[model samples]
Target: EAGVAQSPRYKIIEKRQSVAFWCNPISGHATLYWYQQILGQGPKLLIQFQNNGVVDDSQLPKDRFSAERLKGVDSTLKIQPAKLEDSAVYLCASSSTGQWNNSPLHFGNGTRLTVT
Candidate 1:
């Protein structure tokens, strides 16, 4: 089965420090997304991209968070001056166009970031 891949399965960082996470989506999937999932809350879409171009990023904090999908394949998200509240599981997901509503999305375990 196809799935997304993330690095640094777990990380602990000090507040005000910087960190980065990486993701590789399933091959051939054109839509990629980054989500932040905090305890007790559902995953929230942080950014979405279509073939290297950003489709939506309104919810992302431009002041501290940034992401990019190079060549529309592998992507990376960075957080600078991390805050305690920034601790959460960062998820990466992908799907073929028009696939949503037709099938359920498969999401793998993502990077867990903890700020102390």
Candidate 2:
């Protein structure tokens, strides 16, 4: 019954440097999600994956942001040449299939990225 795991907790980077964050979701969960939470705002879904295939990525910024859930397990989110607005908490969550509407997502505290 392991919960979601994230790394670095915090990061500070220049506006043009690239940064990456990692996440390991709960065991036996079939759906994984990545969210960006800016200060004072609710989490916004960046991408979602059902197993190895992407279920939704409509909100992801394609120009300089990318993500993947390799092997249908651990996932990574990368921001290349970061921007000042990219500073936010990157949260990961997972839920068992068929319980999407009933079960709440288990979220990692998140990796707080700061662009200076």
Candidate 3:
């Protein structure tokens, strides 16, 4: 029984540069999510995917941020023309079911992004 996995635990780039992060959810998990956590602030849901279809992305910044859960197993998140405000920790989480309220989401350690 393994947990969620994320790569490039830390990243640093100049403002306006592009960055991408990867996530591999637990096996059999049907729900995946990406979140952003600014220092001193709780994580904010950026996107939610059930299998390969998007369930929610209302908070995602469409102008610069994009994410996808391909094949309903792995996911990737990218930020283009990254802004200084985008400096934060990006979290990847997943649940075995779509019952968000009833199922618990397991999270990876997260990728810390720094924009200089």
Candidate 4:
């Protein structure tokens, strides 16, 4: 089976600019997620999706970040007016079951973004 795929493995932009990241989750997975990892910190869940509908986004910075899963397969995450503090690795992950289940998450290598 194919793993989650991400593009533009790395990106660099000045503060106040905008950037976008792309992800393609494994097939047949019903749950997908986005996580942000700042250097020296653990990855933090930013949003979760179940079959093209948003399931959780409590940790997402709504004013600066947005994400969408289209038709339950491909997903995109965008940041507007990037902040130096936003420099981090953005990871995409997927599981076969919903949040309540114990299905292990499979993650993409991630897109590393650096805001200068």
Candidate 5:
């Protein structure tokens, strides 16, 4: 399967600035997920969506971050008033089904954000 499409592979911004990243999941994928991977640590699931509805967003920083999947095909993640600690690789992954553990995740190259 082809990889999920993600844009703006790298970004540099000052602290408290806002930035956004876009993603297009693979065709026929019913589940989409966003993750934040800090250096030297495993990727942390930020949000999960089954089609256009959100399945889970417990780990997402709602005060500074937001994401949406419109019509179930594409999605976007945005961070407003970003903090220095928010610097990390933002990953977009898709799976054949909503059952995350049951389906293999096809991940994009990811957008690396740098907060100065």
Candidate 6:
């Protein structure tokens, strides 16, 4: 099976600018997640989607970030007016339905955004 895919392995942006990242999860997976991982820290869940519907987005900084999975397949995340603190690795993962904890999520290499 094909693995998860992400674009622009690295990005550099100035503060107050906008940026977007894309993700394509593994085929047949039903749950997808986006995480923000700062240097030397565990990945923090930013948003989750069960198919095309949102499952959790409590950790997302709504004031500056937004995402969507319009067809329950590919998804995108965008950051508007980026801040210096927004620099991090944006990771995307996927797992089978009803097996979140049991199924190990597959991750992409991620888009490393550097907010200047």
* Local distance difference test scores for all models: 0.88, 0.91, 0.95, 0.95, 0.95, 0.94
Q: Write the per-residue lDDT of candidate 6 for residues 59-111, one digit (tens) a residue.
A: 99999999999999999999998999999999999998643468888999999
Kindly give the number of clashing pairs for every candidate: 0, 0, 0, 0, 0, 0
lDDT of 4 by residue, 36-84 (tens): 9999999999999999999999999999999998788899999998999
TM-scores for candidates 1 onward, in order: 0.92, 0.94, 0.97, 0.97, 0.96, 0.96
- What stretches of model 6 exceed 4 Å from their correct place? 99-101
Q: 20, model 5: CA deviation in Å?
A: 0.4
TM-score of 6: 0.96
Residue clash pairs of candidate 4: none
The Cα error of candidate 5 at residue 108, in Å, is: 0.2
* Model 1 error, position 67 (Å): 0.2
**Candidate 3 lDDT by residue in tens digits, 6-116:** 988999999999999999999999999999999999999999999999999999999999999879999999999999999999999999888456798899999999999
As a TM-score, model 1 comes out at 0.92
Candidate 5 lDDT trough over 10 residues, lowest sum: 96-105
TM-score of 5: 0.96
TM-score-best of 3 and 6 = 3
Ranking by lDDT: 3, 4, 5, 6, 2, 1
Q: Is candidate 1 or candidate 2 better by TM-score?
A: 2
Clashing pairs in 5: none
Best of the two (4, 6) by lDDT: 4
Per-residue accuracy of model 1 over 2-57 as CA lDDT, tens digit each: 67888989999999999999988888888888999999999999998888999999
